[model samples]
Target: MSPTTPHQPVLLRLLHSAIALLVFGSLLTGFMVYDRYDKRFGTLNLPIVPNTQGIHGTIALTFLILLPIFAVYCFHIGDRRLVQSQSMQQLGQQLTEVGKPIWWVSLQRLTNTFMLIAATLAVVTGRMMQEIWLPTGELNHIWYIGHLISWIIMAIGIALHLLMSTKVGGLPLLLSIYHWRIRESDLPKNWLKGFKIKPNSSIALIIEFVVIGGIALAFLLPLFVTA
Candidate 1:
């Protein structure tokens, strides 16, 4: 395939679009909910939505439902790209590697990892927070605090994701996902065949799973603390 030609896999494109919508929706509604209830860090005076908390909760549930599918696809098909190399001898070497496709790809993977982690944290913490609990005069719930932190992380993670995607793939890579012309051989039926594991993929898969587990652990911490 030519470098400029759009060549994203059909399934990956679909899943990416679906997950992006859910994640962005959750971010928007979650921010509204935060602004309405928890402006302890100051306020943006963002437009208030009716039943903002309920709307945010619904978006969160939708995100959680779709997250597993994306997570699995990422691990099974995209895990090799997601795992960082353990052979980096120094931070300087890694910094020198920037601007190349490999570096951008690695940056993309790392950003995706953190984005997933932050999203999970937000969902888990938001679920733990009582539905009736609003900031009102003052708020002191541990889950609420955790949710705030996750929201901040999610925002930063998403910002980095966009920047890195642009830096690495530019318009061609970004547009590839939105482009609709899948090659005849790259249809949905061929997706499973393409997912066959590589010879050295076990180590990469292990790293991917470890990262995912650590993110889940972040989500579970509040429950353990509050218990």
Candidate 2:
């Protein structure tokens, strides 16, 4: 494929699209829920929606469900696109003046990692939340606070992600993630054909396990805890 006609794995596109759409849906419905019930800061001039909380919760659950699989892909299959051990060193070198795509690529990798981490935070906190907590006038819960902050972080992260992508790979790279036509090399069967841990991939594996473990605990903890 040519530079402008960039190619991406079909799986990556599906995961990316699903996660992005679900996340934005969650954000919208979440805000509506907040606007309807917990308006500590301010309120929008929108009509109250009775099922906003339910809608938000559903979207969040869906996002959480797909998160682990996507995490695995990022940590292993797409590790090259994430922040590397020398990412800071690379970013540090070009902090003063912008010169090459190298620095921007490093920044983009770091942003991708951050987005994953931040999304995990959102998921865990959201799962920990009670559907009735906000509606019942209890807004100071730690999990709710974390989820709220995560929403803001995700909004900012999205902007940085876009800026970094545009800076590093330009329009072709930006469009690559959305490109539907997959190359023969991107076939799903080819992904796992002889797939094995790369040298020094232990760190990625560890991090992936940690995130997945946290997600599992988030869902399982509520079962053991009282309310």
Candidate 3:
């Protein structure tokens, strides 16, 4: 790909960074909240971090404020180049070939759209629970259930997005978020020439293991310590 606008690249990098932090931190805190409040499931306990309620609520609100800004930036400047990118086009073609019903597309889009909205709601409700601003409710079971359901759906959407991205060289796109210094030679010479990146399989595996293990350990540590 040819060099993109400097401002746009910088903005994309910032948005990506913020989103990554929010997602990881919020997921960790969510597990903590589950462990503390919903202990019926024996496997749910984890002590990777303490004081999770406050930490999670804070991060959620921070992300809530950041999302609209990122969304607007994405709409105004980001999505066009991203959608037109060779990787994304290939990914779309693969999805189309999957031969799922039209409802699948509709459902995916609906779930994704509402997942963002639901995340916002979860953040707001979490803040209310924290008394950081004002109480929205009494923190009843229904509200907690809604928050958990929304989070699960959002996580599912994220997983789907990751799976689909792999078809379109997802690792490179992910790397581009952090490593922006692509050589000019790496660019596609023509539409016929494909874009490719060096495969660092060991690094990839380490990252995968760390993330999956971190989440699992976050849940199990508390139980082992207690035992």
Candidate 4:
């Protein structure tokens, strides 16, 4: 079976779907909160929800919890795809190699990595931001600025991720993450069978570790900040 068409493993599919839903929820509520509370650039004409801040905070909390779980799953089960190829030549060659097996040495890796980074930024900055602070019209906090930048990064990263996924794997690959059917062999019961770390160079591993550490720090840093 082609990499693009193979049935996604059940466990991974579940995790992916949950993460996607939470991310979407977080993004939507986040936009609404931004529009209602902070319109420094240009105000959105959409109906303002008075409670959007609460909704946004709720969704952000859920996203924060899910992200670490997804990160661990991706790191262990899917880290190879997050790794970049050593050379631009290899990446370029992979781009040209349509119909080749799905591997880490492609533009998809770049998009995936960027999306993870953006999401991490969003979660960290979101956590650092206070709902009361926004309602008071205080838009000058460093963390709030970081959160705004993360929102932009996340928006671009998500759009690029979808576009590249379509170009590389088409609709089937996209749907595979949420597909209902799972072959018995691909069931959760078989999750660990024959599973092994996908080959990645030391440099790739190091990069992945650094990114993960950054994400961890993002989640933990606010705890140390004094009021």
Best candidate, lDDT-wise? 2
Ranking by lDDT: 2, 4, 1, 3
Question: Relative to the unseen true structure, what is the C-alpha lDDT of residue 161 in candidate 4, on a scale of 0 to 100?
Answer: 84
Candidate 2 accuracy as TM-score: 0.90
Model 3: residues with Cα > 4 Å off, grouped in runs? 1-8, 48-50, 81-115, 128-140, 182-227
Candidate 1 regions with alpha-carbon error over 4 angstroms = 1-3, 86-99, 135-138, 196-227
What's the TM for model 4?
0.84
What lDDT tens digits, residue by residue, belong to model 1 across residues 22-88? Answer: 7788878877887887777888999877998888777777777677677767777756545455423
What is candidate 4's lDDT per residue for 127-208, written digit by digit as tens? 7777788889898998889988998888888898888777767888777778788688676678766544653566556655
lDDT of 3 by residue, 1-227 (tens): 22332222655676768976897789878777766656454445566465566787778767766766654444334433222223223435554455343323433433333444545555533433333211233334544656666677668767765554333334664456676554543344522232223212343334334433433443455455431
**CA shift at 103, candidate 3, in angstroms?**
14
Candidate 2, position 45, lDDT: 54
Question: Per-residue CA lDDT of candidate 2, range 55-126, in tens?
Answer: 888888888889888887777677888878777777788446455667878889889988887888888778
**Of the pair 2 and 3, which is ahead by TM-score?**
2
Task: Determine the backbone clash count of candidate 2.
Answer: 0
- Candidate with better TM-score, 1 vs 3: 1
